[model samples]
Target: MTELLDATDSQTAMLADLVDSVRAVEETIARLSAVRDGMLAIASRIAVDVARQASHPDQGDMAVRSVAAEIGAAVRASDRTIERRMDAASWLVEAFPAVWAAQGAGRISAAHAQVIADAGAHLDHALHREAYAARAVEAASVESPNRLRRIARRIAEQFQPRTVTERHRDARELRRVWVKDLDDGMAELGMLGPAVLVHGMHDRLTRMARTITLENAQATKASTEETGEPDTRTTDQLRADLLADLVLTGSPVGHDSQTGVLGKIHARVEITVPVLTLMDDDPGASGSPPAELDGRFPIDTDTARLLAGGVTGWERVLTHPITGALLAVDRYRPSDQLSRHLRARDQRCRFPGCGIAARKCDVDHTHAASHGGETCADNLAHLCRRHHMLKHHSPWHVRHRRVGDDRGEHENDDTNAGRAGDLIWTSPTGTTYIDRPPQQNAVTFTEDNPP
Candidate 1:
């Protein structure tokens, strides 16, 4: 194996040797991936066992949380993500033995197996699962995931015989919007719904922003900020402005007309700016230290000032003179000091991968109150509604222990100290995983130095 990596052997020997080495590595990766999938299959069985045991109140240790809680914590993955993998694994083993066999033989990768399993999931599991699996796997060998989806959809349409309108109606029932925080103080808003309706909205926005011409772009390039320039907006800029205009002011959309009704859109925005930066009075400022927006994304000092001017009666934020503790808000709906600290410290759900904003989560007792859990920071952590209920109703247990200097814990770090404390989650299966609080700090990265 070590000889395979030797460039001397590859460079001096026939090219076929190098090709063989590459194929060896690829085969090893495929086999490892297949083994992991097999483990996932075992996990799915454990989930079912835990779920069944928990459902029977007579079982002592097995009377635990939902299968998702146990397996999800054990794997340190999102509950939804684990559920999908389990569904894929279980479906392949039970309904599509041929595809699973192919995967085990390394003829198809794990991804290919999952694609085949997921594509046929909507079929009638009882009567048509075998039929669907047989058809889907035949194409799986010759097709990619995308093509498999098309093949499965075509097969499903034939077997189920649903009208296009009926399918559209069903798809509309699953419409939702979600937020994902990005690395650079930005976030993406994802909209999922009827494909045609969503795509049409984008098409309309694109058409509305198509007024920009090359001539106008050229004229604006030479124009200074001091000089009045022609409309030099790019396609994206125009589309954004159009969206803002329509939302902020109930204006009509598109060149002709749009499909949706307009209303006065009310929004709440929070920005925290350092006092000196807010006043533009900081002399040491070089690249303008960023301000916190919505307590998540960061923005330039100029953007902060602009937003500050637009809002009415901006709230003043104060910090402790020494430790930078957020001063108590005596006037702003007072609450328990510890609860406030917990809320701030846990900006979002504290579960391994759940990101529901903490403000929207329930302050859960790490140990059951009935089990003598106290209402202190160390005994508390934010769990979103689903997980909060999950912890209590199932066998999942949460424990918190200090990991760093107790005296140096930040004021907002109380619920768990963003990184100071270790929160251990024990699955029904008796596996433990730790969740670290989210914090922001500067990091430096340098590429390999050239020779």
Candidate 2:
């Protein structure tokens, strides 16, 4: 028992050691992958430059394709070693322009140089130069490339417009002409006009001017200068209040027929609810029964006209010839019959990855109806708008099949008769699959049934 226990303990230690080794290897691999990615970006840029240079006559027989092949071969020397080296070199060249400049100046480490080279790719030359200057001054401070990118983005956003051209135009018109009470405020505002006083002034300034009179009065406070209170009302609020006062007080010209003073101007709006009904085939049900449709639903003028079928707010009722049922407003018999037949045949969208219901789909004729295909149920299939357009415009091919033998020895089965069962979809690259009709059986019995 002791011997067996010792063996088990030894096995456990070996497994633990193995796990530790795997973890260490994984961490190393991740670090190497990150380094390799950086190098690849640099290598791609180099390849592009090399290809452009190789097109010249001076570089006869030397081509980018040949250089790329050599690089590929070197990388395969030991799984991705060359790639890692190239990626590292590329990152150094791309990120640190300042480092390269400093190298020319006989200062800065290779690692520090590489960071500048990588940063250089995304930044403008002037910005890079500025960043380099800042870095030189603050050598101990570590600069993050990500923070630099955010700063760059903020600088770009500053140039963006606060409002559109039309909005600016409207605001200018409102400030210059539509707004009133300009003359009084203009004198207090110094050289600026009344338009500037009303529109351009900040919220605090407008609020203070509105509540606090420039002149001192005989009540409560001894002097207006003694009391200090922050202006609470916004500029928009003050403007609205001022406009209300102007409208309430009659205009200087006095009320006239064209002016229509606030009190004189009168307007009225009327709203009415109409009757609605659901009609059917029976002769007795020809007209709506008072009790059946008795204002149960609120019908607007438009809906009332559609249901009642008249020129103004109602129209004549039309019935289906075969069923003798009241039809929907826009529907006519032959077209509706075709629609019903199509709905019955293709009960759901036929696309391979789609299971949309027929009610939400459009009936698509497999063969074009304009090319003499009958407008019958058998010829139609349900497809949602997106898949319908995809079928019509894209390279996907759909074939409809009614009868087919099961995948076994040939014996014509009557079980599959008359059912439009299969649809074979062929992809652009010639891959095919048989999309079976949705099974109706509650219990799906297969070859091997459970005991």
Best by lDDT: 1
Candidate 2 weakest ten by summed lDDT: 289-298
Tens digit of lDDT per residue, candidate 2, span 37-146?
45555555665576567564424222322233234433333213444455565554355434444433424434434444433333445554456534532341243344
**Candidate 1 least-lDDT 10 residues:** 442-451
What global local distance difference test value does model 2 have? 0.45
Superposed model 1: Cα runs more than 4 Å off: 1-24, 53-75, 125-132, 155-158, 211-227, 244-265, 269-289, 293-297, 308-339, 367-379, 399-424, 429-437, 440-451
Assess candidate 1 and give its lDDT: 0.65
- TM-score between model 1 and native: 0.70
Model 2: residues with Cα > 4 Å off, grouped in runs: 1-348, 404-419, 441-451
lDDT of each residue in 181-294, candidate 1, tens digit only: 776566676889877787897888788777455556666776667456468678888877787676576654553235454433366665666665675555135333467765
